[model samples]
Target: MPKWRIGYRTLKTAIGAALSIFIAQLLQLDFYVSAGIITVLCISVTKKESVRASWERILACLVGLIYGSIVYELIGYHPISIALLFLLFIPTAVAIGAKRGVVTSVVIMLHLYTIEGVNVEVLINEILLIIIGVGVALIMNMYMPSNEKDLTWKQVRLEDCFRSIWKEFASYLRFGDNSWDGKEIADAAAFIEEGKEMALKNVDNHFLRNDDYFYHYFKMREKQFAVIKSILPFISTLDRTLIQGEKMASFMEELSQAVSPGNTSAYFLVRLNELRNELQQMELPQTREEFEVRSSLFYILHELEEYLLTKKKFKPDPKRTKTVSAKRLNRDHEQRDTK
Candidate 1:
C-alpha cells in the first residue's frame, strides 16, 4: 500500500477516538473514563502492535493505581503531601512510558484525595473503568486485525534476484552494449546475497511453493549474467578491431543478426555454445592488444558456440562466414575522405 494511505488511516483512527470520547462525555459519563477507553480502542484498531501496547498500558496503569493508593494512605490529606505523592511516581511512569497510564493514575489520585467521597466506591469505579477500556480494546482488535500476512522470506529474496537478472539481460539485448551499469549490477548482487541468506533461514531445508519457480528463474538469471559478464571486455575489443580497419564486417553482421531473434542464423546456437566454453577457460586480459587479439572473430565464434551449447548443443552451418571484408572498403572510403 502507498505510505500516504497508511498515514491517512492512522489519522482517521485518532480522530474517531476523539469523537467517541466527546460523544461519551455528552451522555454524562466521566470524561477521563471515556477518554481511556477511546484511547485503547483507537490504538487497538489502527496500530500494528495494538494488542501488545494495550496490554502494556493496562499493566502500567495497574501498577500506578497500587502505588497511588499506598501513598494516599501514608501521606494523609495535605494538598502539598498529595502533590508530593503524585510527583514521587513520575519516575516510575516515565520508566513505564505509557501516556494513558500516567494520565489515568494522576487523575484518579487527584479525584480520590480532593473529591468529597474518600471511600472505596470511587476506587472500585476507577478499576472497573480501566478494565472496561482494556476489554473494549481486546474486542475491537479481535474484530479488526492488522492487514498483513506472513510471507516466505526466501521466496521473496529469490524473486527479487530473478527480476534483477531479467532487467539486466533485457537491457544488454536492447543496447548491444555488453558493459553492465555498476549500480544495476550491484543491486542484483545484493539480491543474490539476500537470497543466499534466506536460503540459510529454511528450517526444513526444502523448497516452498514458489521456491521451484524461483529456482528456475534464478538459473536463467545466472546464465544471462554470465553471458553479459563474459561479453563486456570482448565488446571493447570488437570496437577496437573496427577502428583498426579489420575486415570482419560480414561476420559481425551475421553475429549481430543471430543475436536478434528474428532471422537468426541456423548456426547461432552452435556458435554460442563454442563461445561459452572458450569464456569458461578465458582469463581477464590486461592489455588492449590481448583483448583485441584474443577476442577476434575466430575466438568470438568459438565463445558464441560454447555459450549456446551450455543452454543446448547444436549443429553449425558451413555456409556461415567466419570473416567479412567490408571494414577494408570502409577504411578505403575514410582514406579518400582524408585525402
Candidate 2:
C-alpha cells in the first residue's frame, strides 16, 4: 500500500471547497455544489497561480454564459446546440488564453442548458457561484508556508558535497591513491538539480519580487560541477607524480575550502593566474610520461579557471565575500614555493 498523508494543498482544497459550498447555500444560490467544484479546480500551489487560474475560469464561465444565451435562444436548447456551442467556445477560449478554464465554463453552460433559458436573475446566480468559488480559493491560497529554511539547508548540503569533491581531487593528485568512494560527485549532481527545481518553485510563489538568487547560484554550481566531471578523467590518467601536481593539489585544497555562496572567485582567479605564470617558468619536460602528466595537469588547471570564471559571472553579494589583499596573495604564493 502507498504511504498516505494529507499535504498542505489537499487540506487547503478541502477547506476551500466546503467554504464555497456553505457560502453559496447560505445565499440560496442555484446549484451550490458547482461553487464547491469550482473551488477544487481553482486551487493551486502558489497564490499567483491560484489567482490566475480562478480569473481564467471566471472569465471563461462568463463567456460561456454569453454564448449559451445566444445559442440556446436561437438553436432551441437541443443536444446538437450544446455540441455546437462547445465547438465554437473551445476555440474562443484557447484564443483568449482561457483554455484552462474550459471545463469550468462547460459546467456553467450545462447549468443554463438545464434551466432551458437565460435571464438576468439566472445569470446573476451563476456569477455569484463563480465569485464564491474563486473567492474561497484565493482566501485559502494566502497561507503559503515559508521555504527559506529548507532552501538554506539544501544550499549547505550542496556546498558540502562540492567541498568533498574537491578534497578528493586534491587527495588523488597529491598521493596518487586514496580510499574516496567518489560518492560526492553523484551527490553534488543530485543536489544541483533538486536545488534548481525548488528555487524555480520559490520564484513562482513570490508575486511582488523575484527571489532568484538560489536559482542563479545553483545554475553556476551546475556549470562548475560539469567542469569537475571533465577534470576527473584527466586526474585519473596521471600515473607519474610530479612536483607541479603537488602545487596543483594545494590549489585544489584552497578551492575546496572556498566552496561557499560568496563570490570569492576573483581572489582565487588571482592565485590561479600566478600559478599559471609559475608553471610557464618551470623547466621543460625531459621524458614522455612527465610531459603527458604536466599537460593533463595544465588542462585541469584551465578547467578550474573556467569554473572560477563561471562563479564570477554570477557575482554573489559583495558583503558575503571576503576581501583578499595583494600582500596576502604574495605571501601565500611565497609559502607554497618554499613547500
Candidate 3:
C-alpha cells in the first residue's frame, strides 16, 4: 500500500479508539471496560508505524500494567490515590517511549482508573487484556503487512546527493563564464551539507540492516561525495584562470552537457579519469595560485566524472529523444523571452 494510506490508517485507529471511549463514557458505560477493546482494534488496524514501534508500544503497556496493579494494591480507594498513581506511572512510561511517552502512559492509567476500584483481579485482567491486544495486533500486522520492505530510503538519500552535486556543477559552469550567481554558490554549500548528513544516515542504515546491495550503493555514494568535496574549494580559482579560460570554457561546456540529461556522450568520464591521473602525477602546488589552478581543474573534472559514472550505470533510453528535444526547445524559448 502507499505510504499515505498507511498514515491514514494509523490516524483512523487512534481516532477510532478515542471516539469509542468517549461514546462509552457518554452512555455511562465503564471506560476501562471498553479501553482494552479499543486498544486492540487500534493496534490491529494501524499501518503507519513500523513493527519496532508496535513492539515498543506493547512493552510499554506491559510495564504500565505492572505499575497500575501496584497502585491499585498499595494505594487506598480514593480519586487522589489513583491520580497520585498516575503521577508516578506516567513519567516511567515517558522514559520508555519518549516520543509518545506521556500519551501512552495516560492511555494506560485512564483505562485503569475508569474502572471502579483497582484490585488484584482487575490488575491481572488488565494485564491479560493488554497482552491479548498486542498479540492480536501482531498477528494482524503479519498478515496485512505494510510496504516497509520496499522503502528505499538509501536510494532517496543518494538521489538528493546527486541533485546537490548537479547544482554545484551548474554553479561552476556559470562562474567560469564570468556570470556566476553568488546565490547558487551559497545554496550549493547548503545542499552539500544536507547531502552529507543523508549519506551518513544511509550508510548507518545499510550497516545496521546488513543489506549487501545497499552497502555497495553506499560505497558508490561515498565515492561520489568525495569527488564533490575535492572540487568545491577550487570553484573560485576558475574565476581567475586567464591563461586557461578557453580550456575552462571547453571543459565546463562538456561537464554541463553531461549533467543536462540530454547528452549521451561519455566524454566527461574520459576527461575525469585523465584529470585524476594528472592530479596523482603532478607535483603538489606550493603557492595559492598554483593550488587554485590545480584544485579548480580537479573539482570540475571530478564532478563531470561522477555525473558520467552515474549516467552510465542508469542510462536513459535513446528512444526518449523527443523528451530531450522538447526540453531544449523550451529552454531556448525561455532565453529568447528573457532577452
Candidate 4:
C-alpha cells in the first residue's frame, strides 16, 4: 500500500505505457497519448487479467468507433451527437460487462469526433493504434517474475507458527504453569488469516482446489487452534496430577511435529484412540469435585479427538488403501467362478 512499494507489475505497466506511446508515434497515429492511456489501463496484475482487459477494451473500441462513425457521418459531429452516442453506448457497454473499457472506448469515439468523420482510412488507423497499445500491454504481462517462492516461504512460516503453538499446548498440559502468554494464540490466528489472504491473492485462484487450497488448510488449523484454547479451562480448573495430562502432553508433542501438509495424521489418530482407551480403563471418580474434574478432562480428550479427526478427515493417508475389503470381494468372486 506504500507509495514507494513499486512492485514488478508497476514497473511492467510504466514500461508498457512508454512503449505503447513510442509505437503510436512511430506509426504516425493522430492520438498517440490515447494509446499510452489505453496501455496503462490494459496492464493488470496478472497475465490472464491483462489479456482479458485488452480483449474487452478492443471490443469496446470497436463499439465506440462503429457508433461514432454512424453518429458523425449520418447525423453530424456536434455536442448533441456526442451526448446521444454516449447515452446509447454507455449502457450498451455496461450491459455487456465491458464497463471497465468505458474510458478507452470514449477516447476512441472522441478521436472519431475530432476528425469530424470516420472514413475507411481513419477506421484502419484507429484499429492499428488500439492493437499496438493493447498488444504491448499483453506482452508486458506475459511473464511475471515468480512470487511462488514468497508464497512457499509464507506457508512455511505459518506451519512453523502452528508447530510452536502445538508445542506450547503440550508444555501447558504437561506442567500446569502460567509460563505461556495467551497473546500467542491470538498471534497464531492473525498469522493464519493474513497468510490465507496472501495465498488466495496468489496466482492460482481458479485452478487450486481441495488439497491445493492453501487458505483451507490454514482455516482448518485456526478452527483446531480455537479448540486447543478451549482445553485451557480444563487445564486450569482441574488438578493436573489426577488427570492423564502427561499422556495428552505427549500426544500434543507428537502432533506438533506432524503438523506439515505432507504428514498424514494416522499416527496422531492412533495415539488419540490409545489415550481414549487409557482414560476409559481408569476407575470412575467417586467424589463430586473429583467427578467434575474428570468430566473436564473428558471434555479435553473429546475436543482433542475432534481436532485429530478433522486432520485425518481432510488429509487422509493417500498411500493407505481399502485393500482388505477388496481382497475379500476378490476371493469371493474367485470362489464363485470355480463353482
Q: Which ranges in model 1 have alpha carbons more than 4 Å from their true place? A: 1-42, 45-48, 76-87, 93-100, 113-118, 145-165, 168-170, 173-278, 283-339
lDDT of each: 0.48, 0.86, 0.52, 0.75
Query: Candidate 3: where are CA atoms >4 Å away?
Result: 1-15, 18-29, 32-50, 79-102, 114-116, 119-176, 182-233, 239-245, 260-269, 276-292, 298-339
Ranking by lDDT: 2, 4, 3, 1
Indicate the residue-level lDDT of 266 in model 1.
45
Q: How many residue pairs clash in each candidate?
A: 25, 0, 1, 0
lDDT of 4 by residue, 1-339 (tens): 757788787898889999999998998888888888888998877655676777889888899988888878878989999999999899988888888889999989998888886788899888988998898988887756654445455555556666777787777766776787776667777777776766555543233332245556666777777787788677776665755777777777887877665545677777778888987898988899888877877898889888777776565233222332244357669989999
Tens digits of lDDT, candidate 1, 277-317: 55447677788876666555446555544554443422222
Q: What is the lDDT of residue 29 in candidate 1?
A: 48
Tens digits of per-residue lDDT, candidate 2, 133-249, equal: 989999999888877656666777788888888888888888877698889888888888988988887887888999887788889989999999999899876753667777888
Q: Worst lDDT window (10 residues) for model 3?
A: 145-154
Q: Considering only N, C-alpha and C atoms within 3 Å, which residue pairs clash in candidate 4?
A: none
lDDT of 2 at 169: 87
Against the true structure, what is each candidate's TM-score? 0.43, 0.88, 0.52, 0.78
**Model 3 lDDT per residue over 1-339, tens place:** 755455644654565455545544454443334443535443533233424555666566667667766776687556876687767766776677633434554566666766746667666655554444444444444433322222233343334445545554544545544343445434444444554454343333331353233334444445655665566556556644343434445555555444433344466666666656756687787889787777667667656567457556643434333444455567669989999
Supply the TM-score for candidate 1.
0.43
